[model samples]
Target: MLNIRCPYCEEDRPEIEFRNAGEAHIARPDEPDRVDDRQWADFLYTRDNPKGWHAERWRHVHGCGRFFNAVRHSVDDRILLTYKAGEPKPDIERMLREREA
Candidate 1:
């Protein structure tokens, strides 16, 4: 029902067209016991739950078979930006310009 941006096609695609993969840029600790409870908790539970400009990792399952980042707004349900898997995530305007170039 929601419209999600496909990082590959660089277009505002529907959510149904894509799949909801887990959090992005999550690196596990090298040593399990060395990591404290707070750190573990952060890895396990803490996520960027924001009202505006929330950065999340997404997979273009149906399109490019690539993973990228998306910046979206939760309150208004607007997708602000999208970027390639390795490309830097920027504001919507900057991302659009990067995609154009």
Candidate 2:
């Protein structure tokens, strides 16, 4: 079972209590109506599907009912860390390299 920490709740909870909301940090078009159809479609439907470490958004649906950011290792399904929506992303890869050095 996976344990996810909710930044808002400040505690770890079972994965069942949360819902993976897919890739995070996507930027919205400044002028949506002016964008080409293909661009608009891409924004709405396209998302990162990486094989390695990835950053994603998750909703604590059964708990705080708030959304948070989480960096997870895709291959192992291991969550590296979680943080508030507006908080800066942590450099987990750099930290890992440092640890291995």
Candidate 3:
């Protein structure tokens, strides 16, 4: 089973304890009423399906019950890192470079 690290709990737990919450870093419209139907639809439905490293939101349901962000490799389904919810997305390119060093 996949192991996911919870940023809040500071421990690695089984994937069964967590729930994938979908793509992270999605920004809601500043004024929902002002947004057109098409814009609203795009915001609600559109998401990146990248083949490589992707940032996603995950909830530690069975553990801390806190939501966190994680960078996972889509091809291998390996979680590279986890961070708190409001933290800025990490630079994946830099991280890969550092890993190679």
Quick one: best TM-score, which candidate? Answer: 3
Q: Extract clashing residue pairs from model 2.
A: none
Give per-model TM-scores: 0.66, 0.89, 0.96
> Lowest summed-lDDT stretch of 10 residues in model 3?
1-10
Which residue pairs clash within candidate 1? none
Q: Write the per-residue lDDT of candidate 3 for residues 1-101, one digit (tens) a residue.
A: 89998999999999999999999999999999999999999999999999999999999998899999999999999888999999999999999999999
Candidate number that wins on TM-score, 1 or 2? 2
Better of 1 and 3 by TM-score: 3
Looking at candidate 1, the ten consecutive residues that score lowest on lDDT are 87-96
Cα displacement (Å) at residue 19, model 3: 0.4
Q: Model 3, stretches more than 4 Å misplaced?
A: none
lDDT of 2 by residue, 1-101 (tens): 89999999999999999999988888789999999999999999999899988999999999989999999989998888899997777787896788699
Of 2 and 3, the candidate ranking higher by lDDT? 3
